[model samples]
Target chain A: MVLEATLRGIRLVGDRTLRIVERIGATVAFLVMTLVHSATSFRRFDLVIREIFFAGVQSLIIILVSGLFVGMVLGLQGHETLQNYGSEQSVGVLVALSLVRELGPVVAALLFASRAGSAITAEIGLMKATEQLSAMEMMAINPIARVVAPRFWGGVISMPLLAMLFSAMGIIGGFLVAVVLIGVDDGAFWSQMQAAVDFRHDIVNGIIKSLVFGVAVSAIATFEGYEAPPTAEGVSGATTRTVVSSSLAILALDLVLTAFMLKGWN
Target chain B: MERSTLNLWVGVFVLLGFFAFLVLAFKVGNLSAGGNGTTYTLIAHFDNIGQLKERAPVRSAGVLVGRVKSVRFDPVHYNAEVQMAIDTKFPFPKDTSASVLTSGILGEQYIGLDAGGDEKMLKDGDEIKLVQGAVVLERLIGQFLFNKAQDSGADKGAQK
Candidate 1:
């Protein structure tokens, strides 16, 4: 009896695991289809340029403000902690390394998810809800090529640039707080950061992370929208799913990428 | 909005992104000042590298001239073999001695070069002959205590 019950429980878990694998396979297929359509969409590059403005330009303000405040907080906290050990001069290194390695890309992506990601989902979901997608199909128009591809390409192009801006601004904010405001030696601030932060190791890794996050976030946002039910409630649910799932995806991918990158270091 | 205006904004955004990249590369990270220009490799041997790591800076008389490219253990020699990429701009005499030195107290260790009066200069792939390993703090304290004990012992003998 106990053996039979255990066998049933194992089968239950195996069934659920298979379901998740099936869902992942479907998502990947959808993403590949979107990319295939995006090839033709590239002919009308104006649509992508417009989407870039909407997705990237519109999200710049929040990214810059959050970046500056985060850097200032890092500077204040780092100085307070390092001063105890009489190493306040190294605050710049602390701020730069942490921002470049962890905070800048991850935080910027989280913000982008809420800002542009939700917008894309809502727009696409609303189009589906209003039967606009059906109307496009009736016109023999390819909605994925015309609508989805542009947004996907825009987001992919924008994420790394936004991340770079965040890192650059945060470093400036940190310098202002640590050197100008808190009276740490200015030369030590920049020089120590230069010594500690390697271009290929830290900066390039940060760029790579933002690019990965961009692809994951854009894919999740677009997929959720395209698959949403043609109703107000379903569209709303997909928008929420876009934000939550993409946020989780960004963090999980960051962990995996960080582990792989750090292993390359001695 | 005007089509030209929209195009202008996108162009501006892309330009801003590239500018941000430049600032990050030069200001935040050391892409401009690092071992980027022309650099030649030099090898050194150390008994104990302690906590020295790859990409550590190499300085000659407090001025940075290169970077440590790699660190490996030589099985036959039983010593640490370090490869440094030194800038071609700063050439050192072949007889220069390399010493691993720490900055301040509890700071990161770097390789420091003391130039000799040799006529020849260190070339690419040349191995530095004189190399001093990192100074471990515990070993220094132990040596100091041992010398103090010996001095007190001699004092006690003279009194007796």
Candidate 2:
């Protein structure tokens, strides 16, 4: 009897786990559909505007500060190493390449994910826990459209803007370090950069990567939020999942994009 | 309503900032819109074209006069062919020497032109002779290692 009961309990747990997974998958599909439909929802202008503001404009300060510091550090380290070998003019290329290729997208995504991802997860989780989602359904409103779409659009727009801001600030930061700290000639820095850097491909790649990151972060966050169970524990779990999953997705996407971008270089 | 209005303003501002930054990048960085300017082509043949990329700058007296338009290997001659575009204003004299130069100890290689004393200017398509090839970094590193090994050997011999 004891063995039979244990087996029954295990089966029940396994069934419950499968149900949760199915629900999560369903939520993701629903989110994607909602996002697609949002393209036609002209009435959601307020929501879209609010999201752009919250995600992009308000987040600029942090992105700028962090980007500046990152650039400064890169310049300081790169300058020291390059100086040891008597090749200081290449600092411009190093700063520009690193900022455009890696730092801009990755740093912006990580920052946005940490700040907005957790907030989105918690807000949606709380809504679910409090039965607000059910209330929206009862009122004949689409919760995904009303709630998730705005945040998703906001993230998609904000991430790329944040990345551009980061790259700009990073370049300035590197310039400051090179000119003031390292005593590299201002003319040389600008001239060398002008000659070496190509804006068309590198800047476009950074922006494209940022857009992809934004989509990933928003989708992951919304998925985690909408699928949270009706419990406090579930809410916290969703928040954790949103942050972790978004960050990991950003990193993985970065690696893939980097490989594609650098395929012919080697 | 107030929140939405605020959000609108914020969006406008962010858009403005992004555009402004892009303008600044172009102006401050002096990024050339590729293929926009008058270009004269100069070709150089190299036994080895290490770390040379297309669109790399061609410098005269440390000023960028042109850029490497393309790099290809001439299998018949067994030499790397580099095509560069010089600005229309700066006519290259026929005797100019092209040497591959590295920017720093650890930097990308670019072609540097030494203007030769020839009153005759190079035309639309001309090949620069007297090419000084890239400073093979691997060879330099090898030389450093060998020198260090020789110094160590001499020190040990003296001690013995």
* Model 1 accuracy (lDDT, Cα): 0.91
User: Which 10 consecutive residues of model 2 chain B have the lowest summed lDDT?
Assistant: B27-36
Pairs in steric clash, model 2: A87-B104, A87-B105
lDDT of each: 0.91, 0.81
Over 4 Å off, model 1: A1-19, B145-160
Q: Which whole-number lDDT from 0 to 100 does residue A252 have in model 2?
A: 90
User: In candidate 1, which residue pairs get closer than 3 Å at backbone N, Cα or C atoms, i.e. clash?
Assistant: none
Off by more than 4 A, model 2: A1-31, A41-43, A79-83, A86-93, A175-184, B1-5, B27-47, B85-107, B113-160
Cα error, residue B119 of model 2, in Å, equals 9.6
* Interface RMSD, prediction 2: 2.8
Q: Summarize candidate 2's per-residue lDDT along A141-234 as a digit string, tens digits.
A: 8888888888888888788878878887888899889888888878777766765455655767778898899888888888788889979999
Q: How many clashes show up per model?
A: 0, 2
Give the 10-residue window scoring lowest on summed lDDT in candidate 2 chain A: A192-201
**DockQ by candidate, in order:** 0.75, 0.25
